[model samples]
Target: MSDPFTFQMLVNYLIIGAGLMALGTLGFLSRRNMIVMFLSAEMMLQGTALTLVAFGRYHGNWTGQIFTIVILTVAACEASIALALILILFNRKSSLDVTLWNEIREPGQPAIVEDPAEAEATEPVPGVESYPVLTPAGIEPEHQTWTVHRD
Candidate 1:
């Protein structure tokens, strides 16, 4: 049998779980991409699961593991539904940007609009290409034209 979890181990697990939750929250709130936001939400769920497992192990009970399993089931279902919704939304908007779906906001809430001037004022980073440069490899093959007789 494995040695029981020490107090320090429990504390470490809790700290790591909390960190994951914090990062997930930040990503969810700051990112505009639907996929990224979904991943962030998943991260948060995983963090909670981790914490639950740690607690359950520490207490020598099956409750935490059971809860984690239940959470995993719910998360799987949520992922499928969320993916379908994202596909439909992408089809409608031709983009995964969350801001494009302002119409779906609460009825009484005002739409948030970004200032065009501020957007235009932002400058690109100096001495950095927006895309990666791939080195060319090998020589190009020679092409030959062929004439075919009609059947």
Candidate 2:
């Protein structure tokens, strides 16, 4: 049989779960990318599930595991729906930035619009691309020009 779950272990699990929840909350609040936000939300859910499982195990009951399973099912459904919404939103906006979605806010709410000058200032500088660059490989072959005569 496995060693019994101790109070120290439970505390440790709770701490880790809390950390994950905090990180997820920070990511969800600070990031502007839709996909990143979605992932953050999932992280938060996972943290909650972890805490539930830890508590259930510490209490010597099946409740935590069962709740975690239910959470997983809900997360799976949420994933499919969220992905579809993201795809549809991307198709309409051509961007994954959440700031572009202010138009969908509640009717009574004022739209949040960025100033043109500030937007320009925030734009990425040219020649400093974020992606990696590949160098050319091998030598270029010489080509012979052939003349065609028509009669």
Candidate 3:
């Protein structure tokens, strides 16, 4: 509770946070695997949280801690959603590569081809987008009546 956060310690925390952010950015950019990319995003979140906690500690306020909690909560939700989606994606393609999604574009859309020089570490594939088409259960609402005009 009375721990003093010296300038040196603050700087170290900031530096470490910055490093984590940079690493996460790099990994998110260079990797094509969905899981890996998500992991990188988590890393970035952790880094930002770390920086927030450091600042909050230095200022002797709960703002940083509160923000960190929110960040962690968001990260957890994101991870859970991402994992579920990844499982679905893996089931569809039988792999965790990201490049396979390039083909799921509009008609005549050029396939997304990653330059080997830019990101040679990831894999690739071709795919189509499919979604359930739902029919209206009742009478459609009129769009004109839904509009609100303010004078």
Candidate 4:
């Protein structure tokens, strides 16, 4: 209900909002865990909402309140979807490190490892075939020896 030009009010709002933003950014950047990353993203969203509310209060406008509510709803949806995705990824890989996802390549194709050292190699038995051949439905096949060639 007043002009948005008070020095003390502005400083207070900036301090709170910017502090939240800084914490969110730090978490997002420094944390390797996917859960923490998602939480940090939500923190950023909360900081943005806080800034909006502060501006709305200072300018005596209802639009900022409406926007803040919208942001909250969007944040909820994002959290739900992100959590679901995290669960699925964890189930598949059993780890939340972004580095584990390096197998994901562009164009939706499985990434190829070039060097033998970089590849996950399996120990082979002396007289046994290394690769097993799998046939289509209702078909049985023989096993074979195969060497993977990498770039």
C-alpha TM-score for every candidate: 0.73, 0.73, 0.68, 0.64
The all-Cα superposition gives candidate 1 an RMSD in Å to the true structure of 10.9
Better of 1 and 3 by TM-score: 1
Whole-model lDDT values for every prediction: 0.89, 0.88, 0.86, 0.80
lDDT of 1 by residue, 13-63 (tens): 999999999999999999989999999999999999999999999998999
> Runs in model 2 with CA error above 4 Å?
115-151
Residues forming the 10-long window of minimal summed lDDT in candidate 1 = 142-151
lDDT of 4 by residue, 38-145 (tens): 999999888888888878877777987899999999998998999999988877767676556766557887764435386557688656476675766865676652
In TM-score terms, candidate 4 sits at: 0.64
- Model 3 residue 33 distance off true place after TM-score fit, in angstroms: 1.8
For model 4, which pairs clash? none
Off by over 4 Å in 4: 1-7, 105-151
- Positional deviation of residue 74's Cα in model 1 after best superposition, in angstroms: 0.8
Off by over 4 Å in 1: 115-151
Task: Rank the models by lDDT, top first.
Answer: 1, 2, 3, 4
True lDDT of residue 39, candidate 2: 100
Q: How well is each residue in 49-120 modelled by candidate 2, as lDDT tens digits?
A: 999999999999999999999999999999999999999887777778888889889999988885646643
lDDT of 3 by residue, 23-65 (tens): 9999999898898899899999989999999999888899999
